[model samples]
Target: NTLDYDYTNEEYDLIYNPLKMQGKKEVEVEVWDYNKVGKNDIIGVVNIDILPSKNKETQIELFIQPKNDKGEVQSNLNTDQKLGKISFSMIYIPEDDYLKRLRDAELKKRKTEQELIRQKELEEQRRLDEIKRIADEQRRLEEEKRRQQEALNAQYIKGYVQFKNISVSNLKKMDFIGKSDPFVLFKAGESSQQTTVAKNVLDYQYLNEEYEVLYDPSVMQGKHEIEVEVYDQDSVTKNDIIGAVSVDILPSLNQERQFDLFLQPQKDKKDDSSKSETSSTNSDKKLGKVSFSMNYISEQDWIKNFKQEQLRKQKIKDEIIKQKELEEQKIKDEIQRRLDEQKRIEEEKRKQKEALDAQYIKGVVQFKNISVSNLKKMDLIGKNDPFVLFKAGELTKQTTTAKNTLNYDYLNESYELLYDPAVMQGKHEIEVEVYDQDSLTKNDLIGAVNVDV
Candidate 1:
């Protein structure tokens, strides 16, 4: 018998089934809660497999809830408990056995997949390493072939050759065949030989694959030992040699030495032809007498031109000066216009202030006269001097003269003054003088009277 347990949703299901054919099977299952199970919570079973004569202590694993219904597991568990015992003969198997086998196969398949992925990574690394190794070998072979070609072109011999007493017509072709720098040798006679050295060959051409010829006739006709040296473009001497050849002087035969020479025309001869034609034309025009004064007018024309240019410049300068004067005059006129406008405005303001001050002084003078007349008519002054009476009443006073004074006080509604004998009581002459605070005279009245007072 095998015992299997599965857990779901905080609950566990235990299935006990016989493995093979068996008689009576009795299993005492003891489960101990380890991580999250409490007391009497089954977590595993001992003696889960029992046969007829044999008791198998198969510790069957029980799936306990990793978390309880509250989504938390206890840190420790209590002791084991005997869940129950089962006794039965060979019977049916549980359905969870097939499900457990399927779960084990899936776990094995996942492990195999992880191994395959690791092997693929290792194979790709090996392929990259192999590609880098092949590229390094091709660069080494190309450097070896370039060094062998320069060694074969550096070997030759050196000598000089000269020619004498041999006509240049006799030697139509000359070839110096060796690795040496050879020269043409010229022989003068059988016993006496004059040799001219050829420093180097000229007009050398390679006719075939291996032979080269010097084609200049002057070097071939020379009677000296020619010093020849073959060099490369770097001026390194590859070959040097000296050789001599005798030139045989032949007696004069039927040969006339004739040569063609070229001469250029003289300058005066070409000028004389043109002068003769001019003279002939001048004779024909003798009657007309084409007279010309060989006079130089450049300086005079330059002076005139300079004077004209100066006149033009002076005109331009005058124009510029006139424009500047006009600009300045315009600016001055603008300033004067602004000044006139400002003066006009100031004059108008002065007139307006004078008018306003005149009106204000007139109103004040009228108020003083009215106040003095009303005070005298209403018997508002005491019998002592009106100035003294006003002073006693805490009014302010100004003595305009020895006999005339201004007595004024301010009430809540209006300003009042008293002029005692200057303004009479029944028919008084109120000589009231009103002045500004600066004591400058504003107005004066002679007999501002009230009839009743």
Candidate 2:
């Protein structure tokens, strides 16, 4: 038997029918180049020995030169010429072993299928968990938004409306007897208040009637209304609605406090049963009128206005205090400046008096080229810095320092001696002292002398 095919790639798997021989046998494999024009050319051929005992192992062989019909390598061709390679496996199994191998393969396939299904289930569960997480997050966000709106609306509630001195006039006659007993009812939103009945009168005035209603303008923007209904009292039947008037709250709040509401007639139940709609003429029938004083004041506005007034008063008070402080500081500064000027004037006058008295000195001690030689050292390692001091009565004068020199000469210096006839009438003794200057301590006195002036 021969198997032939065309393959385009490097790797391929081929299956062949079982060989007829058992145990061990040799199989010859041939490689050929196909030609469409004539017989195919023989590329190479190889003989491979098959052992049934090692059936699980595959044999790989490199092809050599082709063999002749005698089953011997061709001597005419170059036998070692390199060609392509081939690999194949041959297994021989009895009937029982073959059936066992098939069962094992089936079990492996089922295990692989079960593993794929488990992975799919895990993926689905993870997807569902992600969806639940997203849903929970959205709900939390919406709940937070709702709470924020609720908080905002709480601040939007403003204040209240007060209705006082309620009365009604010229109510319709509903009964067969005398003037109908009439009362007034005021309703706003979910709240209602009524007045005592004034029996047997066409006109009625309610005594000590007052109603205060809480107002939240955020919820009352366009829909809020006040309904004033006049009802006539009857002992045996339902109270008759003489008329009713509805006034929009926001506009009425802006208008004058006194309201004269002309009522509109109630719908007749008998007429409503017989017809689908009432005519405009019948619906426009006039009833009585209700009179009341309505007042609305926002507590938020009142508190804000009160705070502004307090702030204005406090600002005025602070301004007055600041002005007073500024005035007092200004006066204190003026007084200090005057005191400083007085001290400066006194100093100048004293200096002038000293100059005038110095002009009258009776005697003068003149110093020129007054030198000192060989003064003792006052420091650890330098020549003495020397100076001379002259004193006559209460006056003293000092010469300039000679600066690290043993000899110092007072080149230009003078001293005046006052001759008070009461104290020093004549010759005064002048004291001359030579000293070494030490900045860190007292001056070191070296010598002294008295000179008669």
Candidate 3:
């Protein structure tokens, strides 16, 4: 095929596919030189071989030879010759092979899509199964946990109720001369906890006691109630119901709360026989109010608290003993001080009596007749002369003898002594001495005499 060049000098593209492919392997081209003359001269003739698998565009070169009318090769060409060579391309493509390849590619795409769809379905199924398994395991674990908690709670007393100040309000007077003999009866369900009587107190505090009960949160948390009733005792008639109160056992675990509940009066004994669970009693005849506090305590915890209380009480007892010892010591010290004070007072009185006795003087002394029994001798045959002298205290008055010679008649003499009353009253002493006149040596002496004045 020959194509015309465009009007402008620009590049051109061409795509060609064969409609019929028999067995053509090569192509031939002939060129003729044309002029205004008759019979165009043969310019050249060219031949090209097709290359296998060259489906894309290709370029080729061919050498052409000039020929005359006799069909002889011309070696020389004038400057006015039209053409000298030819260039073109021949591409051969196998249509059957290309069509087979297209069909194979389409088949491979379909297979890949089917495999992806199958894998998606398998993933969805696995997700659903895992969700169901997780749900079942969670439910089983929750059931097990609930059962364990209940068992632990049942092993101990988890609740307590303390009843105190159970009294009556508008008490029905049972006696004429005195007030009614009132009493309180406390009950946990049907079991009686305590029954105590009082003589004549309107707001009587009958019982202050703590009671233990089982408290199961699953079974009987808020439903458990403690019942309290007041009754007026009598000698001849049956006990009359004063009032009754019921308090709910609160819900808690390891925790406690206190409540002050009022006792509602029940119907007359002729109407009702037992205490009702409801507080729908005679409002006008409200027996009175009951004061009590309830608490929740596990059995083990309750025992531990009891031990702690005992220790506290023992410590207080020891402190009291020490205080008593101190008081006794104080009393003994006070007695000793009083005895010492009394002894000191007695000693002072004795000293005063001694001082008064020293001021009074009353004793007297008188010298009687005195004689010299043994005198100092001056010679063996001659007798010596002797005389007696007397003295008392500081003042001494000797006796005035009225005899010429010293004789036994002259020995009797009296002396008068003077002294301070305080000094003389204690000890009034008088002294008497005898002396003899010697002729040659010192005076011979007779025996001396001493006396108290």
Residue-wise lDDT of candidate 2 within 1-453, one digit each (tens)? 234443555443233335655442556667777789999877777666545434365645454666678867564333466555544554544556666977997898898889889988988898999899989999999999889867745544466667887888877788898878998887656667778888898787887888866665555543345667789999899998898766545444434477776667664657422211112322434577778887655667646755998999999999999999999999999999999998999889878856755554565566566888877776788888888888766677888888998876666665555545335433346789998888989988988998865
lDDT of 1 at 446: 33
Per-candidate total of colliding backbone pairs? 51, 0, 2
- Cα TM-score per model: 0.16, 0.28, 0.37
TM-score of 3: 0.37
User: By the lDDT metric, which is better: model 1 or model 2?
Assistant: 2
How does model 2 score by TM-score?
A: 0.28
Q: lDDT winner between 1 and 3, please give it.
A: 3
Q: Model 2: runs farther than 4 Å from truth? A: 1-158, 217-222, 252-256, 267-284, 299-453
Q: What would the per-residue lDDT of candidate 3 be over residues 1-453, giving only the tens digit for each residue? A: 232222354444322344443554445457765668689766676544556526665775556756667765454323334455555655544666556755876787777777777877777778778888888888888878767656654543444444443445556565676777777676654445655677865666545544555444444442345556677788788987766765554443355654444556564658523433433442444445555545656656767877998998998898899888888988888888888887788788678757865654654445556554444554455565666776655655544432224355554455445545555545445667666655577755456656644
Which candidate leads the pack in TM-score?
A: 3
For model 1, the local distance difference test gives 0.34
lDDT of 3 at 79: 30
Error of 2 at 298 (Å): 2.7
Q: Name the 10 consecutive residues with the lowest summed lDDT in model 2.
A: 272-281
